[model samples]
Target: MPDPEEPDVVSATDLETPPGLEPPPTAVRDLLAPDRRFVSARRNLGSFAKTGDAARLRRGIAQYVRTGYGGAGTMSRRLGSVSRTARSLSQVLDPGAADRGLDRALLQGNSVAEITDAVVEAACSSDGTLDAEASRESIRNALSDLLGLYSDVDLLRLTDAQREFVIESFVAHDVYRRFALDVGKHLVDNAPTATIGLSRLKQARNYIRQTIAESFRLLREAGQSMTTAHVRSTVANALTNSLVVFEGYLA
Candidate 1:
């Protein structure tokens, strides 16, 4: 018989249909809201770019940064950061170049988490006291700058499928980050040996990645349209179930 105190080794069968696995609003909203905002900002930036009105573009960038980056207060600081980044883009106004950049950023398997990580790593000093707020500001600015490169025409021309792919990719990356954080928190709290913690975390990451891919596949196979709510529910259910299994392992 299996040891009662040993952590349960989860399998494909174990992951199916977790009982009473209701998705929590906190997790759902945390993942969904930013994704929606990011998608919306891309669409709006495309619209503004089409007009070729510099003032409108600036205003749109500020609004997008405020909404998509965070919330309402401290608008001036965010706007300034965004504006500075926008100013740094190549002034040649070549829509083709801008389009290529946008494609590389969004469509080439790039994730917001990756961009944020890059910015944070670059911004941090030798000391452990990293200015997290500054890192976020830089990320917002970087995104705004990238969007500023393309004309509205370039952005508007993208097919629906392209936009959907970008949105889904962002959601997937966020899900991965959340799962990593959850596993890290558990390991930290439990004070497991480094080797054990690292091994468990790696396993958890692989499982989460596979679960997310399968969830998307099933949705597509069923002819169901993907939405923030649906993705959130699917991810949250998987994460909750995985955590239960992980806690069992820790026990």
Candidate 2:
């Protein structure tokens, strides 16, 4: 029989009803409202918009992916000097610190918040400024709301179908947070705007989400076990395919 758990089985109208509680949000546009308190996330919004620096976005996402499946990954391999310094301080002074930091690289079963912390930490610009610790907090909230539905699922040992579902949702959620959380003028063409182009923003967010999700649909089947290395490979594929979506995508 066909694997009932395959992501393809879930239609657009489908809401993931996880056992006891109400269905977790499958359409996250409503939950993506920017946390204006996170000034750094706001800075991230404005900075990434102009530079077309998709790589930085990819790097942040890679951290989240690695965290889910245990990856001290190569995303940091090519970070420019500024980002390198930030990662060193956070990952080194923090992760490798003898006194109070991580004694080893993160392995499987790490918490999802590590995704937000790693992304925010790697993107930090200075030592103690909120610029590094922006008033924003969307990634954590969005991912928590969406992935929380799978609380019973063992992320490290997912079937291919479940793994793909997680990957697609992650890409969509990441893209959604970047845009949906832009409650400021960072993503628009003008200031003094009333709505912040909410319509266009929605169009863009949904479009990217759909695009990345479709990329995973092209796969043949969900046969493999999501081993650590397999998770790494798929995460890399997710990043590459996600970049492809952004290439034709605007804003």
**TM-score of model 2 relative to the true fold?**
0.37
Q: Per-residue error at 207 for model 1, in Å?
A: 1.3
Off by over 4 Å in 2: 1-139, 147-164, 176-193, 220-226, 248-251
Residue 183's C-alpha lDDT in candidate 2? 33
Model 1 ranges off by over 4 Å: 1-166, 179-183, 188-192, 226-251
Q: For this target, which candidate reaches the highest TM-score against the unseen true structure?
A: 2
- lDDT score, candidate 2, position 142: 33
Task: Assess every candidate by TM-score.
Answer: 0.29, 0.37
* Candidate number of the best lDDT: 2
**Candidate 2, which ten residues in sequence have the lowest lDDT sum?**
15-24
> Candidate 2 local accuracy as lDDT?
0.37
Model 1 has an lDDT value of 0.35
